[model samples]
Target: MKTKDKIMIFFLTIITFGTIWIYWNSKKKNNKKNELSRSEKISFDINDLILFLGDINNIQNVENTHKKVKIYIKDSNLVKTEEIQKLKGISSTLVSSEYVNIIVGNVAEFLKEELSRKMEK
Candidate 1:
């Protein structure tokens, strides 16, 4: 009704809208980050990893830790270390003597199980 009351209401409305917009924008950005991370996880390919580990036949033993996959190969020279490090979900690669340890994020357990099964058959 009064001019002062109208001006106050307008400023309050703008502040409320601004707060809502900032909150919504932050939430949207977080969702997008989550989606990108999920996509990265899904991009992991066990077949490619196995191939880079010098194939199933070359592998002497496969072990999985919480966040790493330790693969013991008959001949470490047969492994393609560079290629294995480039695969999705692979954080890093470590080579020691006859074993190669791969940091495969959360998929290490799954990879170990798959490799074990392949070795059996």
Candidate 2:
């Protein structure tokens, strides 16, 4: 083969490899970004939930029952039912005249613990 042909093939191979490398790196970065955003969203939801329940002070008690977290509030009027319903992972909310009940699938225990810790602090 001519030297020109050999050089062309080499350059073509380099270009192909460069494209693959760039694609792979971009995919990895995108995966990381997606993971970060998901975690941030969960954290934001938990924090916002605390506020919607009328802060740590208003929460008199927290109970976890499988997929549900029942929060006893000092003043039911302070709870924001509309905002709580809009949160991402909240499966359902059962607001009574005196308390707040939220279902967050398997994260109920975690939610209860977070609320308890916040109250302690």
lDDT of 1: 0.81
Model 1 clash pairs are none
- Per-residue lDDT tens digits for candidate 2, residues 78-116, read 889999998988878988766889987777777788889
Candidate 1, which segments miss by more than 4 Å at Cα?
1-42
On a 0 to 1 TM-score scale, where does candidate 1 land against the true structure? Answer: 0.63
Cα-lDDT of candidate 2: 0.82
Q: Residue 51's C-alpha lDDT in candidate 1?
A: 86
- Please report, in order, the local distance difference test score of every candidate based on alpha carbons: 0.81, 0.82
Where does model 2 exceed 4 Å of error?
Answer: 1-44
What lDDT is reached at residue 99 by model 1? 95
